[model samples]
Target: MKRIFTFGVLAVALASTVVLLAGCGGGGEEETAAIGAVKVPFWHAMGGPLGDALDELVLEFNATHPEIEVESISMGRYQALSQKIMAAVAAGEPPVLAQAYEAWTGELIENGSAEPLQGFFDGPDGLSEEDLADFVPGMLDNNTWDGVVYSFPFNKSVRALYLNKNLFEAEGLTRAPATWREYEDMARRLTKDTDGDGEIDQWGTAGQISAWMFENLLIQNGGQILTDDGKHAAFARSEGVEALEFMVRLLTKYGKVTSGYEYQNDFQAGKVGMIEGSTVSLSFMEGKYTFDMAVAPLPAGKQKGCFVAGTNVVIFAEAKQQEKEAAWKFIKWFTSPDVTARWAAKTGYVPVRMSAIESEAMAARLDEVEGLREVLAQLEFASYEPRSAAWYAGRKHLEEGAVEGALRQILTPKEALQGSAEAVEAEFLGVVPM
Candidate 1:
């Protein structure tokens, strides 16, 4: 949906030190397969159930394709993994395949640390036309920048509204909120002081004022994060203020929501009636909540909109021909319709392929899963994160703006946004706002 508001905008790893370094300094337009079993070092940030699911897929792939062996390594988290990868790249040693975000992809591209996948895709051993057509509409496109595809979607997830069905039923609300006003009203209704204490014991919702959440709100408020040329900030306008205003009001005015990561714990403990989080959280949340949990698309503001996040698989430019070939093979196998469908089912990520999502297998799997359908449905209205390297710095400024307005109350929403705009423009575009 097109945003309805005015001027608003939106928005690792480390591994084996020695072995990683030993596999460096080789690159070519075309990859050649090795005769023996080729070990592809793959780095990812997923842990717990998601990590287990990834390992299982690698095992399955290796079992079927004996010539290709994938060595999957959990790098703790995305930030840590990213730093380690960059260090490895600087040392002329990097993994054969690794999970990365668009921001990272932008950096890697600029540094010539990542390989463009366009050639591979158009090559003889590439995905067939039918296979390419099977991908979710925007999934593949999201990985492309400047007509070159540098990565493929992996472990992508969309933000979803998680509702406490029991609380909603108690309030006589049979369905999730559909708009901003409805969400506010429901939030107010759900908030309570159960023990008659002066302080409220339960909150209507918990909010995370991150760049991604801000971007979703900004777009929903009918604003764009950057100008058409992608050289200036555009989100500090009226629409931006309105978006931030809405977010701030939820906490400062209505007292419907609390800030911080504690919301997840609160939601599970039944102290918060609603929480918006990634689809991947479902794997960690399963059997953890005490109440009947339900998922729904984010409530629309002027229109329905969302932002999809998570990493994409990128082959380091330093990888050898054989390893590169093996990496692409693993990438292809991992993102295949059936494979991605099973991955989604097991790891709580949204499947990247339309064919997989609509397949009978996915249908059956969704039936067994509680909230998978709602998360998948969000793809229809989602947008990709900013693909420019500028976004890496811009995101921090955006987060600061949100914090100033929503948490600290140090600045009005408009002031916060304007300050953020100026900071981002100066830092990234090297322009000072007048």
Candidate 2:
């Protein structure tokens, strides 16, 4: 689940209105017991079945915890959620809890709009060490900043290769490719003009120009996005160039470029042999495709690497103490082993807690969905993207400037990536004073 937006616009809008945070301060706690339960407003971007799954959990929480009433507000999409969050924060009236990507969390933290969760983590009702250890390490790391916890992972997902079993069978590919070389070979074999019309009716694979996919390839090829101090770009090296080149090769020779979830749609329609997308994509495809489909871990590049996507939930500092406590309770309940397992089963998002993978819900789901076990296994080696707010705009530059430029044959891989790197460096410099 990748989110698209131009952070430069949000940052510029925020800079002019950030001083409002100092003027309109946090509200005092009201005696809610005298009247009713404390209200916690949660803003999110989950839509369709994902929204349904989230709403079910919210209803369950509200019914089970009589002292708290959570209002789940859907912003419809990520771009709107990001814009609204910025507008609300600027006006000093942000929601009590909200879904935020790492970049948004970083911006909120820098502006003193996000609450540090370490105090809650060590509070009387805090999670024990055992509970903390149960979560995937990468998930925890994604929500942490400056050695402190600022948010908790929610709806986290890893990229997966969805295979059209019929296509693979026809091509005599018994198993999913385990390496990039094998993948290319399989792609070459799977692409075909089935009707003898001299036009490729069935493509080997299809995808959009995605920075997330590029990041996965970059890391698999042993490249890091930023240098050690998180201050400079390091992805314009040979590893990145090689990654971009591979994407261009596939698109040009064996696959096709698509927009949004068109690749997933094409795969479901049996027009594509394979497609690279998030694990959550399964939820969208369920009951829609007629072909025998299977999910696989992404084809490895030199070594295995996967990037975790999706957003985390954060409690705003402007909320009342009671509302903050209520929000924390909801966060804890939502991420519990059984709850997370059920969420995974319902939404096709990977469970954040390791124990959830072994839960009965996940086991039942694995039985229903082919190759889900392999997809979930990717968490062991998965990593996250850069947490700096600058990466938001920087990622757009990668997709539009580097990935698209190289794919469109407008620039060589090295030239495209180097230009994106310079632009990202400038963004980092621009946000230093903020």
Estimate TM-scores for all models. Answer: 0.87, 0.90
Misplaced by over 4 Å in model 1 are: 1-36, 253-260, 369-371, 430-434
Question: Model 1's lDDT to the true fold?
Answer: 0.80
**Angstrom error at residue 368, model 2:** 1.7
Q: Candidate 2: misplaced stretches above 4 Å?
A: 1-35
lDDT tens digits, residue span 78-160, model 1: 88999999999889989889999887887888889889888887887798889888887788888887888999999899988
lDDT of 2 by residue, 1-434 (tens): 12325677677679767767644422122222224889899999999999988988888888788799887888999999999999999999999999999999989998898998888979986999999999987788778888889999998999999999999998889888889998889999989999998999999989988888899999988898888787788989899999999988887689988777787788899999888888888899889999898889988998899889999999999999999999999999999999999999999999999999999989999998788898899899988888777778778888899998987889999999999999988978857622
Q: lDDT of each model, Cα atoms only?
A: 0.80, 0.88
Candidate 2 Cα deviation (angstroms), residue 103 = 1.5
